[model samples]
Target: MRETSQLPAPGSGAFVFTAQEIRELDADLARRDLLELTMEHAGARVAEVIHARFPTGPVLALAGGGANGGDTFVAARHLHALGREVYVLAQGTRHELAGRMRRRLEGLCPIELLTEERLCAGLSKTRVVLDGLLGTGFVPPLREELTQWIRRINEAGKTVVSLDLPTGLPSDTAGDGSDAERVRADLTLALVGFKPGLLFSEVGEVQVLDLGVPPALLERHAHASCITPEEVRALLPRRVRGAHKGTAGRVYVLGGRPGYTGAPSLTAYGALRAGSGLVALYSRAELPRHPVESMAHRIEDWNALTALPRPDAVALGMGLGEDSVPVARRVLSWKVPVVLDADALQSELRGAGHDAVVWTPHPGEAARLLGIGTGDITRDPFAAARALQLAYGGTVVLKGGPSVIATPGALRVCLAGNPGMATGGSGDVLSGVIAALLGAGLSAPEAAIAGVYLHAAAGDRAYARLGYGLIASDIAHEVAPAWHVLHQASSEIL
Candidate 1:
């Protein structure tokens, strides 16, 4: 086990573990007689959560004959011991529960064995259905009976509380295009550490209960942050009294071809709004004739990049089209950090300064960079991201829901943001946000993670103002408000 003292603070993707990996860790725990102790601890923690949330029930636990089921049995015993009328709906049979679990249940309760018929029959009025039928164990496409059962429960709108992860959904993609058939729970009590599926997938609003996995044991394999408010606060530039605009950071936004100019202009504005000291735009066209001219204070020809004042960081390819590729090569041989988005990433991982580049790609752009199909990258993004990060020799922001920020050994998921962020031009704003934070003295990964979280949070705030009608500019507009809320609170709290 890696030392707990050495673990990165939670939000930096430093705690979530895979089911198989955790099972091995638990085996190591059991060889030392710690599995029962761990399960007991887990059950009690779950019980505490149920108590706090419920006022009354006909609580039905859908127990499979597995560790997750065992946890459900343990929870039932504790609740029944406290005089709560709780029942176990064994999805499997008594014969299936014949090992240690049968012995454990011997003195506990009259475990009413469950069937597909029983589950559907009773779930209509049950106060809560504890989804213990599957943990992070099953990947996708439940047995036909289970799929139909989920559809019925969803129709009835019954309250569901899943253990570990919802049943039926692949915790890591081994499904046949049916990701939607998984259990949809209202409350998921994630044990040990958070699993990637819970955050990256739309399971539900999640609550992580500490189950006494020794702090030392967890640091060994898991490296996912269940991002907290405090960690979100530490991302920024420290302002010195004598600091000038250039000294704080000079951010230059480039890349807007004949057909595409709004993208780079938006990128430049996003940098200024994120608090970069000075923002300059070097464009190929003159003001007014170019759509983004109002935002591009400075313009330069394609060959003028060499003579332009040195910028602390550069953002390239928001609007840099395929035709501009030749010009891009001639110009953007960057000395400082650069953000490579859109067309820039489609080129080889390294052209002039790949080591200093930050590649922000939607799955499509990412596929081009990896020389693989988008489906392959989408099915297993974790592996794809690690591959790309090593190939590019820089931080990789695999942007999407629960945006993945990975750099070699590290992989962090940003839990901030909302559904209102699916508008066009969102990526354009994101490229700029990352550049500004990078210029403002954040390391590439820090800037990427913080920039994604803040950008999403700003999108959410923008939605509050204008709902789904939100454009990219509205999100950029809310960046300051969101930053001030977190920054001032950060200055106050941490």
Candidate 2:
């Protein structure tokens, strides 16, 4: 396979549009021959994915009575032509498009009544399930029968693939508002646009399928986006033929107190592994066991720390404790790009130089920064990230399940990380990665985006190898592999 990023390029990713925006795009397309064309293309794409993934399987297609059902019927028709046994459980509507497709399926395959008894009867024989029960227009508090079917589908333990959005998740928002239940899929295939719910919620690995929507139409409407490895490949700095350490970038890490000596070392290690030529760790307390890859320096006082030669970028506040405030204040005057994390956010921040800083805060730290509750931040992460950026005047990374990266006019979310990365020291590693990228010549926003993406991608790779027992250092080690993968893709593309 060609080593391109998972998502296609131009922007290197799709613009995640809200449900209303998608509807507006649909209406505009419906004015032409585009709506039917989109449905045909969507069905073909879903069929192609299913064929490639589960080639010779007795498949079950759970379809609704609207356009979603029509898409399912199309896939079923394609599967039947491939000589696979395709069973469809469809309910309700006799809508025109759906009706036409169902008639086609009747001639080619089996169409069963969507009842609990029939569903349970078919579960044992089916290997894969396609969820097309609801589209983006679905609301919460699903019908009791539908809920029962969803529960049965879940209990079957079959690999479920959902089209568009999952059955019950709201297309516009990340949080499931009511106590309504939804289908939990092993793979969710989103068509046309990206939705925050699909990226943030329990819907498993998601891939944005091209519905053949014109790039011009997408460009006219899309704003928010997700970052891909190809974009990072294009953005990462390269080592020239005769490059030396001095030409490559210097990253300074300032943190680590009495008992927290490991934080600074991890920060320096992350920067070094992320491709910084020279990484130096300066700590208030002596860390005799600092990583051999980085040079260790002593910080007797604020004056000693600032007296050192200027670095291309600085990573601050890994474990400075209460001394973080003074250390961060001193560095603010240095006028270098800085990545502030952990206790560094505790420092009182103000003034014009805020634009040079990249703040990485968990919800609790974000709550502290905005003087709001953590609940509010989790309810709407995009808003919280934007608020933090506007308040601080730089890039803000709101670290959570699906970390949100916000700058002045842009927002991007990374969907690669897993629950294992919630361990301590991960944020410090992220800070170091951002600082290293900044030192290597990317702008503050670009560094934040690339850093967050690479950090998460590394965590994903580590998770695949070691599972949930992953510690912070494991992710740091994987950064090199992640960088290699991204760089390799770039080289092949060029």
Candidate 3:
């Protein structure tokens, strides 16, 4: 919720780690007593959420054999102790879970073998379906049976909560990969560290559960910008009594051709409202919208591009069209950090040689940039974002439903926001925030990290006021308040 412009780009929002990397982080946390403690904490957290929502609802814990399943047992035991009806469906044999995990679930609740018929019947009346069947160990393209079960759970409209990564979904961030299946959850609770799968996939509302993992350890393990409010607010500069318009940061937005001027205008407004001291729109003479506090300077020729103004950051590609192609080609040559968005997406975002950039592409635009169709990129946001990051040589912010921000080097998740943010023009506002942050000097990935959360948090605030009627402009207006609120919370913790 912190003002993203005030902070450096967040670490990667990918929860995914390579197999070897996963083993290392898990082992490290496990060695320090976090293995048992974190799971226990996660389970308890889920139990608390469920109990509060469906306090008296019969709980059916569909558990598997790994650590993910172990968390279910922990939660089931807690629920049972509180006198709630809890049933444990051991999807696999008892031997499947070994060591302390097995020991913890033993005799705590009624255990039953989850045969297809029994599973169906149990799911039929279950108030809360706790999916601990498969956690981070799950790979893509689930087996037929598991896929069927996931579908059933989805259509049944149960308040299904997945522990860690959703069952049937890949534990890695790539999501669905070559695998043809994924679990559609009502909620996914991330523990220890968030997985990239949740942020980019069809997984439901994600909630970051307390795993009791030490801040130091989590920070050490973090490769993405899953930073806390405190960390984000630390980046905001102190507004000394003596301040000038030129002191804050200068952002130059380019990429509006003859017809599409509103896009660039909106981006400029978003930056101005976001507290940028100076923002100039360096688009075709056609797009002339400007912030109320400032006026936009229009550029006509290519030679005037570099001569306009010395900007800290540049934003291009909003409402551009065929003519934008020639202009975008020239714009990319700029040395400053840039956010390639809207129509210029395909032309400007080449795979990987960028010095610093935040590429914003909708599914279709993403497809154009990657040389594929929209369906392919929409099918897997996590992978697409990563692909873009590697290809563009900078961070990629795959905008719209299940948005993802990826830095070529880091992996993390934005554990904020809601579903009420799918409105049009939202991407333009986001580009503005990101550009302003870059202008303020956060790295490419850092700007994206902050932008994702800022955009979502602003939407979350708008939801509180307008509900479904919210628009992109509303979200832009809400950013200032959200920033203050989040910043205040950060100040209190210190």
lDDT tens digits, residue span 1-494, model 2: 11112223323367777777777788888887688778878887998898899887799998888888888888888887777788998886777777887787786787887999989988878999999998776776687898888888888999888888778777766655432478877777888877766655555666789888888887666647777677777788999999888778899999998899988888887898899999998887898767898988877786787568999999998888888877788888888999988998862774434677999999999999899998788767877898888888789999987789998888887756777788888888899899999989888899998899889889888888987789988899999998887888744452
Candidate 2 C-alpha RMSD relative to the actual structure: 4.4
Enumerate clash totals for all models, in the order shown: 8, 0, 19
Query: In what order do the candidates fall by lDDT, top score first?
Result: 2, 1, 3
Best-performing candidate as measured by lDDT: 2
Each model's lDDT: 0.70, 0.81, 0.69
Error of 3 at 119 (Å): 3.4
TM-score-based ranking, best first? 1, 2, 3
TM-score of 3: 0.79
Candidate 3 positional error at 182, Å: 6.7
Off by over 4 Å in 1: 1-14, 91-102, 139-157, 174-180, 226-228, 286-301, 323-332, 490-494
Task: Provide the lowest-lDDT 10-residue window in model 1.
Answer: 1-10
| Error in Å for residue 336 of model 1 | 0.9
In angstroms, give how far residue 66 of model 2 lies from its true place.
3.7
Give each model a TM-score. Answer: 0.87, 0.84, 0.79
Candidate 3, 115-180: lDDT as tens digits:
677778888878988888887676655677887767666666777888777787765554544323
lDDT of 2: 0.81
